[model samples]
Target: MRWFIFIAIYILVDIYAFQAIRTLTKNPWIYSIYVFLSLAVLAALIYQVSTLGAGKVLDIKSMYVFGIFLTVFVPKLLIVVFMFGEDIARFFVGIFMKVAGSDEAQFMASRRKFVSTIALGIAAIPFASLLYGMIQGKYNYKVLKYSLEFDDLPEEFDGFTLTQLSDVHSGSFDNREKVEYAVNLINEQQSDVILFTGDLVNNLAEEMDDWKQLFSSLKAPNGVFSILGNHDYGDYVKWDSAAAQAENLRKLKNIQNEMGWNLLLNENRFIEKNGQKIAVVGVENWGLNGFKQAGDINKACEGISNSDFKILLSHDPSHWQAQVKDSPRNFQLTLSGHTHGMQFGIEIPGIIKWSPIKYRYKNWAGIYEEFGRYINVNRGFGFLGYPGRIGIWPEITVIKLKRKKPQT
Candidate 1:
């Protein structure tokens, strides 16, 4: 909806600017008139945006949804495939006429219809997928079973289970009812600890209230912990004042608190159970730049012993580059959720296929072990711009650490 409004505004501005420039070559009055008209349109758009929001104008957000779908979606394909599905049937009709005989000329006459129908159907799949994604688009939740093993064992911490879920961008969730279902799904895991890797919301920090009720229902046997994701800082949206943005962050943090989560910002906490000790470290939204950089491993790991079984929660899988591999730290496991697989792709039997998001991210999902360090990226519990999960589902990571035999 916002995209449509933005496009409409851009079209208006383009018209006015083009007319204004053309008129400048003739007379001052003509140029002034066009310029004034452009400003008037912009003013009107601003006023309307203030009153009803972009959502008011989008009665049927499907037709011109290309502006929102193009990033990872294609709609023209939908129109040709679904709308003009007759061609597909006629193509088969011609094939039957040519092969089985009877009415070759008649078949030829209607073959294009079949072809058109098929093309439209083929196109309709992704578009409908996008449309359905807009409507019933949901988060994929999978319990990625992996372990980080070290030579030493924390006596009481062995066999501890941590339920990990990440990238629950509440802002992109348009279905309030579905979100409640998701909450129920997460609660069903019932792990000893719940850790959220990041990306709690898509754009605005104020979106916290939207899912407050749903989040309030989440409870674990031990406790819930969270770290800031890139989106949590509210960088994508424009605010009238920086203070407003700051206050928004504060509100987001408060929401986390209300949800019974401990926001571990570049800090560590000890989990002592059965006389065994383990450290849980959390960092801010730090990544490889052009993203957030609030994660401070140094601060998070400060005063930690070398041998502690440290579980670090960093939003980005890229953060493993900075803290896990070569850093002089003992972070046994790091949890991240910057990538939700863009809610596309496949996870089939022996054939993990689909989606181009893999081209951008090496360890986008599942457990990735590099240089003896480990990181797990969650598929996420919410949708983004296109708003659907075709195959690469959202996840609920059930991580159970294990012991590894020493290399003799």
Candidate 2:
């Protein structure tokens, strides 16, 4: 029933768009060519969806789905907007003709080629952007650096540097060379600790099988620590049985351990330098509303004092806004990455930083501070869904801890 509704709407839009194309190019051969190409694109999209079915995971095949949809949908949307506007103008004109007792004047009006040409021109922008996003934007990883000052930070860790990454989404990766390059870039930062805030795989643990070695290559003197994201629990896909799903999660944990990552599940570990220690706590997926809420900050912070300088690794920024900020124990800093800036947005340093997801999640990207505490949301390390990124390129964040100077 849903498919029927979708096809019905899609056909209507296609027909309306084709009519505008016909007006722009009156040649029968050109019209026939456009019709054939449109049908072929639609067929390819339908065939891909049907073939992938319920077991669809992010891969090269998924890219085809996004590509075909953008190719057909963007142009149709532009054409429809122009057609609707022209119809409104024609409606007012018709009313004038009727009032003037010149109803026959309607026969003289025809679809304007300039309007159709303008629609086509406007539609090309997104078409080109999407194409570039798929080809180059996804691999465009940017290393962003931040220097944060804390009044209560441990003096031993004053110059401490930490590298943070999130939303690897290993299942979506198709280019090993590109990923290898990203890993190399990470090593170049040479931070004291490397923290991966989650979405290691899209749905299954097996997704990491191919890239395990590459990711295991990531090194930091203080060690690499990780936490599970909402997608890590195999919750999004149907499992054969409850036991199977549990086993998949166990394997994912084991894989992280094998790669030398301390998979912190509502747990805390201490990082020490020159005998001075700071707490690093991690929690499972804890998103608001529709997402899973498995994180327990109190449980993770057990045995740690409120005055201790602490850093948190949580997958979703909402967790910080909801629970971490007001906790009895003040976490000095929190690192997160679930939002991914919707993998599309414009961020120009201090000038402007905006993404559609900002309306939903206040701390969508970069560093956000409130009530003396801070959260740095990494703009994901990989792409998902759209198989590309537009303006919000993949990010690698490096944060340096600085001690605040006291006023004399």
Candidate 3:
């Protein structure tokens, strides 16, 4: 039923977009090529969707299928928008002509060739962008830096720097060289500590089998701390038995340990410098709307005090608003990643930062502060669902903690 609605929408968009193409060209060859390509994508989509089963995870092939579908569909949807607008204008124009008793007036006016041409020209931008995103933009890593001021931050840890990465959906990666480059980029920051807010794989633990050694090289002075994201739980894939699923999660934890990451499961650790300490509290995956709620913040905060400067690692940003921000516990900074900014959006610093995900999750990406507490939603270190990233490229966040000066 889901695929039915999706394909139905795709066909409608194609038909409307084809009308625009027809207006611009009388050439049979162009029309034949266009129809052929459209049918090819539709057939591929059908084949992929039909073969998917309950236990099947979203693999690389499915990712490309989705990516190709988006590459073709989004531009055509744009064309439909322009053509629909033109049709509406023609509708009203025809009414005005008939009202005036014009001799040659029809129920609707013909589409202008220039308008169709313009629509296609405009649609080409996203078409090209989607292609680029699949080929290169998926691996285009960006290092985002921020210096946060905290009045209660301990003086000894004033210049503390931490690099945060999240949502490493290893199952979707096809290019090893690109992944290596991103790893190198993370190391280049040389932050004091590395914090990974999870989703190490799409589903299976073996997904990281090939890339384990490469990622194990990531180093930081204060050590690498990590907490599970929803995907890491292997809930998306079906297992033969409960034992198998438990074993899969066990293996994933072992893998993270092999990579020198401290797998904090509703646990807390302190990063101390000189004589001052700040709590690094981690919880399991906890998200809103039926997502896994394995995270226990109160349990993780055990033995910690409200006066201590605390950094909370919970994979989903929704946890911040739901519990951390308003809790009696003063969690100064929360790091998370799950929305992935929908893996597509327009973001120009200080100008516009927009993604469809924002409507679903308010703190979907980047930094947000409430009542002096902060959360930095890493734009994700990897891609999932869609094989590529559009405007919202993969992110590596570098956050520096500075103690705010007291004023006279």
Candidate 4:
């Protein structure tokens, strides 16, 4: 039923867009070529979908297939929308002419060539942008640094640098050398501790099999601590059985352990410096509305005191908004990355940072402060669904902790 609806929508939009193209170019040869190309693209899309079936895992081939579909269909959809608007206006104009008893034929205008040209011109923008995103934007890794000051920060831990990488989604990576380079970049930061807020794989645990050694190289004096993201639970894919899904999660935990990462599951670990201690609490993936809610902040902070400076690692920023911000225990800082900024957005430091994901998530990207608490939602370290990123490139966040000096 879903596929039927999708096909119906696609065919309607394609027909509309082809009509607009026909208006722009009346040459028979040009129209023939356009029709042939459209058919070829449609055939390829059908073949890809049929081969993948309903349980698509989104491997490299699947990524390319989806990318091709987006590149071809998105622009056509836009063109169809514009053409539909023009048709509606024309219909209303004809109705008004008939009601006013005027010569409708005199005022009636056919679909203008200029309108078609304009539609094509506007559609080209996203087509070009998406192509660029698939080719170069996904691998364009950027390091974002922040210095956060807090009155409650322990003096001994002042200037403590922490590096965070989130949403690795190892299943989506097609290049090894590029990933290795990213690993080297993380190591160069020389952070006191490395934190990974999750989405290590798209679904299955095997996605990280080849990348384990590469990620194992990530090191810090205080060690790497990680928490599971929504994808790690195998919730998005179909499983053979409940046991099989449970086993997949168990293996993922084992893989994290093998990589020397402390996979904190609704628990807390302390990082001590010069006898001053700060708690690093981690919770399983917890999100709002339809997403899994396995994270328990209260349980994770069980033994810790409010006086002890604390940082919480939760995958979704919504968790911070839903529970952490107004919790009885004040969590000074939280790190998250489930948004991925929709893997597309315009982010110009200090000027503007915007993504459509904001409409769905309040704290979609970067540092958000509420009630004196801070949550840094890392834009993610890898690409997923669309196979690439646009203005919102992959991110590696480095946070420097500072102790605020008392005013005299």
TM-score of each: 0.73, 0.94, 0.95, 0.92
Q: Comparing 1 and 2 by TM-score, which wins? A: 2
Ranking by lDDT: 3, 4, 2, 1
Cα lDDT computed for each candidate against the true fold: 0.69, 0.88, 0.92, 0.91
Backbone clash pairs in model 4 (N, Cα, C under 3 Å; residues 3+ apart or in different chains), count: 0
> Model 1 off-target regions past 4 Å?
1-118, 139-150, 405-408
Query: What is candidate 2's lDDT per residue for 73-155, written digit by digit as tens?
Result: 88788888887797787788778878888854435344456677788889888788788888889999999999999999989
Q: Give me the runs in candidate 3 sitting further than 4 Å from their true place.
A: 1-9, 98-111
Clashes of each: 31, 0, 0, 0
The parts of candidate 2 lying over 4 Å away from their true place are: 55-58, 97-111
lDDT of 1 by residue, 40-97 (tens): 6445545544654532222123212432434222434333333334546656767887
| lDDT at position 220, candidate 3 | 97
Error of 1 at 108 (Å): 9.5
Model 3, residue pairs in steric clash: none
Report lDDT (Cα) of residue 314, candidate 3: 94
The number of residue pairs in model 1 that clash at the backbone is 31
lDDT score, candidate 1: 0.69
Residue-by-residue lDDT tens digits, candidate 3, 207-233:
999999998999999999999999998
